[model samples]
Target: MNSTHDTSRHIGVHIDRPVQEVYAYTSDPTNLPAWARGLAGAVEKVGDQWVATASALGRVVVSFAPPNEFGVLDHDVTLPSGVTIYNPLRVIADGTGSEVVFTLRRQPEMTDAEFERDAGAVADDLARLRDLLESEG
Candidate 1:
């Protein structure tokens, strides 16, 4: 469901559950680590603010959300250059299911290969979410 490139990446999957449940799971950062493969743990508020640490990707604190629809995160990944990563997670409802999009734009000096690698990581995370939800049912 996820992809990477010089172009924008889109990752989506159809869940059998209601849109609200899917949105709740994604919007609540505390629940993120339960399904997100990249996150080891997260602390978050109900309305959608969070600070999280990824087992492999380091720590991140979500900075803002515009109109409660999109989130911007200030993320730090421990790498050689120690660069900051900006990630946006958007959620929208479509009919009976929900659509989630993860967009990443890193430091200007970041290479396309680096972007692709991270994008692929995002895809795997989403896939893990799908498995979690389906398994629960």
Candidate 2:
């Protein structure tokens, strides 16, 4: 099978900490809002999962993981134009800091502006994570 990064989106940030430390924090669903400022409030728990709200999308439940992989359930979220998309988030450690990758295939369609916005959000989150980890160390 093709690697997820082949067709999916990718972003990375290098925190001045051990890979294990960054991975532990990023892989925890509850700490997502700490890095992703767009999340309005604390993530809501469903069953045993926690839901993270994306800026343009509604609630997204991230699956539980220890340190390496973190994923959000693929589900349709409406856009302003009434279009929908199923976006799944994949996060892992790269050397030291964590790398966050998102997989999105157009449902109605995809736009450069939308992709840019999403990419910007991801980048900002990673930058914040790096800053926080480094400062704490």
Q: In TM-score terms, which candidate is top? A: 1
The RMSD (Cα, Å) of candidate 1 is 5.5
Model 2 agreement with the true structure over 1-137: per-residue lDDT tens digits: 23323244656555667766766666555776777675424566778656667654565554443333343323333444455445555545566555555454423244656656666776787788778778889
State, as a TM-score between 0 and 1, how close model 2 is to the true structure.
Answer: 0.63
Q: Model 1: what TM-score?
A: 0.67
Clashing pairs in 1: none
Candidate 1 error regions (>4 Å): 1-7, 39-49, 64-85
TM-score of each: 0.67, 0.63
Candidate 1 lDDT, 1-137, residue by residue in tens: 22333555666556665666676666555667777756546655435445666666566554444334332232333332454455666666667766667765544656777767877877888777767776776
- Strongest candidate by lDDT: 1
